[model samples]
Target chain A: MVSIQNLHKKFGKHTVLDGLELNIDDHGIIAVLGPNGSGKTTLIKSILGMVVPEKGSIHINGKPLKNNWEYRKEIDYLPQIANFPGNLTVIELLKMIKDLRGEAKREQELINFFGVNKFIDKKLTNLSGGMKQKVNLVLTFMFDSPLVILDEPTTGLDPVSILKLKELLHKEKASGKTILVTSHIMEFVESVSDRIVFLWEGKIYFNGSVEELKEKTNQRDFEHAIATLLTGEHV
Target chain B: MFKILKYSFFDLTRSSWSYIYFLFYLLLGIVLLFLNNDLSNAVITLMNVIIILVPLIGTIFGVMYFYNSREFTELLLAQPVKRTSIFLGQYLGVAVSLSLSLVLGLGIPFIAYGLFQSPAIWDFTMLLITGVFLTLIFSALAFNIALSSENKIKGFGYAILMWLLLAVVYDGVFLLSLVYFQEYPLDKFSLIATMLNPIDLSRILILLKLDISALLGYTGAVFKQFFGTSFGSVISLSVLVLWTILPLLNIARIVKKKDF
Candidate 1:
């Protein structure tokens, strides 16, 4: 479970997250949807303690996240970009992360599932965009963290891989893990996420199930409901 | 911190640049010792090179390492690791490896050249000490520059500019100021100025230790008069240590509030 209150963040003159508050205790997938620069990534990074909030406190499982790192042990983060040290081979990178985090509950299994074994010996820089993402995915899911945060997780995946990811995410959710995701693919979000939390201008615009969002916006289709939220249409 | 340091050290050791750096010093030491044919003479020549070159390498290497390891840093930032540990570990990893290259590179030739039996051993040891100190100081400063700069070009630019200012420009300005204010008492001014730049302090320290202050002109005489041989070396070395510690502390402070 993650709790945030009064989160305020700014980049120079622009305010990215302002007086934002969120509480996610649900045990299923929660999609954080927002237009570009709407603080979706900022909100996620805040909870991970990667971005220090100017004002507000975040708690993970009842412990304040300020100046704390141990709480991250229970969290697995897939960064927006899959940039890594190019010199390291894929296997070395995985082993390095595993070594740093002390243990990997299911690394070998995840590696097999993601099919990263094909280019396991190659350097990270040499891998293609989609393959690098596969490596990134393996690194995140290898550790059985209670909280899974995926930022743009579907960046370079093929359709088949994405289907596999959906299956993996559902399995994770079924095991009582809290998964937070952010992606531009509405259909993917709609299919996988149990609850959708829409953000607009640094504030939570809507936090409800898919049916609730559709009924509130008076849109028959899920995509139209989301478009209405963006178009500033009916609530 | 130690684990991060270990990985970084391994990472650098595998890099070809580290080996090239090692070999450059190795070649320099071998050529200098053999050609000079005298321990004391080689020590003095090595002093000149170490004072200037060490800081230059430290700065470039530090900045390059910080920028290059950015992905590694981002990955670590999201994990169960403290911010300070990630940075300090990388900084130390660079400093230690560079120092190793310097010590082993120069030490091999000197030791092979019958250095221990020679009277110039102390001077050689002093040269290595200052070289290591310079490496630690400038790399820490470079890490600070890279940390504060989000753009790699800007970080690299600032790092090189810092080295140029300290290594070459600082002495020129110090002398110009001394000549411009010749009528006034400039002893305190010169001493304070020398202490501010690690390169200058190192130059003065080695010159004083070598008992060659006469060759150094006004500022060296001022340093020699103010702190004598033993005291002057101690004070200069302490300042070098201070230079290293301050930047490292600044890094820790910066990381506390910085966004990844």
Candidate 2:
């Protein structure tokens, strides 16, 4: 559903994404894993057109994303940071997004699932980080978009909410929606993601199923395999 | 774009700072009218205050809002909205809200003091128009600075420096130059220099409209000779419009290539 080719990005002297290419053709959960400053968020933001790549082309659903914004209508993005206009109430924020994107389906259901109804009337500044993340999740999953991108989705989430989030991801995947997530939690990545795309030093280091990754690294567990990939040591 | 404008306007209008700004003008208008006891005199006093204060407020508020709403801006950027619309809409939102504060805050007291029936009605209107222009011009410049500088403190420092350069330093340098070239014909040169600075242009526009060129020195007379004419008025007004447009166009250009 998304194709990125020859992607090159740099922040000052630090190269983020260099000659990287990624293409996904299926509807499932794909976890983007990387160490710090691995260009994972850069890649995601590039797809969302938030970060303009120095040299690259991105196509979403067979349509070239250059100078085009209408395709974003089919995608829902959950930003890593949940900072919003501190003065706006949760409902006002929701309404504003809904107004911008047109009618949103399942908004109420997602809000109920996240149990953020009580905080709807409160300003965003008053909410705890976990509550804010819940609101972020509600905003992301409410819309009936074909693609959902979550950056650090589990940040500041309670265990119950994390379970809800995993359930929501599964439900969306079951409904044939493509979800792209970036997280450092190996257990969460191993449990939910159908395919793992590991990025190392501005390039895709590994792209395959968990079993394939284990077989390649010859490691007994997923986390060790990731460590092995990073250290380049044979077990 | 309108949707973004609507939200931004609402957001700004609700902020306490907008009310404080409005109340400041309101109190200033009432105090000025009560103290001067004449519509024309009060307008003159207001002309001095507005010329300096409007741009300062606009610059500070523009930078503050842009930096403050950054995450929110990112949220909008990821949406289906066009990039230009988001920035332009926010810019307008700040400019328009500030203009409203200047107008209504000063306006209520002036109207209360029987300003509409006075012959200075046109003068008051000119003052307001100039105030709005300054607000738009400075705010757009501030947004440009904020957009180009990622560091908030640096952006704010640059914006204030810009305001200081145009509002105060420009005049000082102009005076110095006119003194250095006292033997030469500086009328045309002074006029062009004044036109280059929005603050100076606004001061001249209001001063000429108020018909107090005699209070001004030789240069003011030269400005009066130019700005007093119909053709000169049109050119000066167009220059103000151009000042507003150029920064906005820069904003559009910068936002397109900027990495959020």
What are the chain B TM-scores of all models? 0.98, 0.97
TM-score (all chains, Cα) for each model: 0.98, 0.98
TM-score of 2: 0.98
| lDDT tens readout by residue for model 1, B158-185 | 9999999998998899889988999999
lDDT of 2 by residue, B44-134 (tens): 8888899899999999999999999998898999899999999999999999999999999999999999987899999999999999999
Q: Provide all candidates' interface root-mean-square deviations.
A: 0.7, 0.7
The candidates' DockQ values read 0.86, 0.84
Docking class of 1: high
Between which residue pairs do clashes occur in model 2? none
Q: What is the lDDT of residue A120 in candidate 2?
A: 92
Query: A1-235, model 2: which lDDT tens digit per residue?
Result: 8999999999999999999999999899999999999999999999999888999899998998888899999899999998888888999999999999988889899889999998899999999999999999998888889999999999999888899889989989999999999998899999999999999899998999999999999998999999998887863
The residue-level lDDT of candidate 1 at A229 comes to 95
